[model samples]
Target: MNPTPATSLSALREVLPQLAHPDGSPVRALVVDDEPMLADLVSMGLSLCGWEVRVAHAGRAAVEAARGFVPDVLVLDWMLPELDGIEVLAKVRSFRPGIPALMLTARDSVDDRIRGLAAGGDDYVTKPFSLEEVLIRLHRLVQRTGVMALDADELVVGDLSLNVRTREVSRGGEAIELTTTQFNLLQYLMENPRAVLSKAQILDHVWDYDFGGQANIVELYISYLRKRIDAGRVPMIHTVRGAGYVIRPA
Candidate 1:
């Protein structure tokens, strides 16, 4: 009952990142947690994000909701009355393999993280978490799923643009060429404008690479993107010290 959620809807809206389906529909979200208060809170918070949301209290109910709701993202609690979150995740993913799932739990051990992720959870949130944290994580998860987008064909921030279909990029009406890796990196940055993306996130989404050892690849590609995307223009991409990179209007 002591959930540390954002103080007000205004605060949530101000801090929360905006996401949209390419078709201009609200994001569909499913909340599965046996704790009624927690479930309700998450459902309400997601609704405030302008998402279409459904809540379930148990694993079986979660799967049923997954079928009827056909949610685009899932916030699933690991321990459930009947089937547990891992089982529910598998069942839901059987029909919707590409759906992004964020697992909720009190267990913070490395083993559990590995287990949840191995079982197809796209992200993990420890218990006693804030609604803001969950909201931010959900934004990252949906973006990684390749479903949430600013527009169907292109993502734009100020004059910077990336065409998802044609793989073309431009800034201030000038064509900018990029290599395949650099293009993917810039595309990811453009997709989540104004949101800080960690190097680990960049590797996972842009390269599908493991978060460790090869993180330098992200930095390298980012530098390449800057040289091309920001050359002779006001910079659109920025680095958040100790956090990650974000793209926004100059």
Candidate 2:
């Protein structure tokens, strides 16, 4: 049966911004999921980030792909036919012990999360997740591994610079002070650059996942950020009318 064209994942995908390896070398990724369409969607997203990606629908295939591809990062789904994600992760770890991995699971239990992490998963995401989340999490995971030898800590958008380690944000030649929450919101915005982020997305990322509050809190924080970072200068924080907020180069 053909899915409605407009409702398919392919149709939902927009022109994603590109993210690249710092060394100008090619970055490879392995996406393991039994769901063919989900795997394909994820592969597409990673490819858009200018990374080479391989998709494996089963656990054995995942391990073989890992051996041959030597991917910089792995996105593994917890459930699969034949061998499960944990089994695949264990087998892959045998050879690529230091390889960073992100686990995707439908289970939300604390035990499940701990098991995946104890099994060598460097990060975790639940199923029905956004492709953007996968891309960002995997990007962070790869950076943490130091295999890419990239300057993954510092970020710059035009004149605004953010140092993840120092927690310092600077505008042009001047330093800007920010609260922890404000800093996190700005960091997420800087990570995405020109892309518009919805309030819900911002809440999920900048705020805690279980942060049961309204979008007003995001707006309140954005205002605080604007006052501290953008006031009396070329504004970097912008509101997209009915959409959401974005931080562009000032």
Candidate with top TM-score is: 1
TM-score of 1: 0.61
Least lDDT summed over 10 consecutive residues: which range in candidate 1?
143-152
Instruction: State each candidate's clash count.
Output: 0, 0
Candidate 1: segments with Cα more than 4 A from true spot: 1-9, 148-250
Q: For model 2, state the Cα shift of residue 136 in Å.
A: 1.1
Query: Across residues 165-207, which tens digit of lDDT does each residue of candidate 2 receive?
Result: 9999887669998889989998888777667898989989987
Stretches > 4 Å off in candidate 2? 1-23, 147-250
What local distance difference test score does each model get? 0.81, 0.77
Backbone clash pairs for candidate 2 read none
TM-score of each: 0.61, 0.53
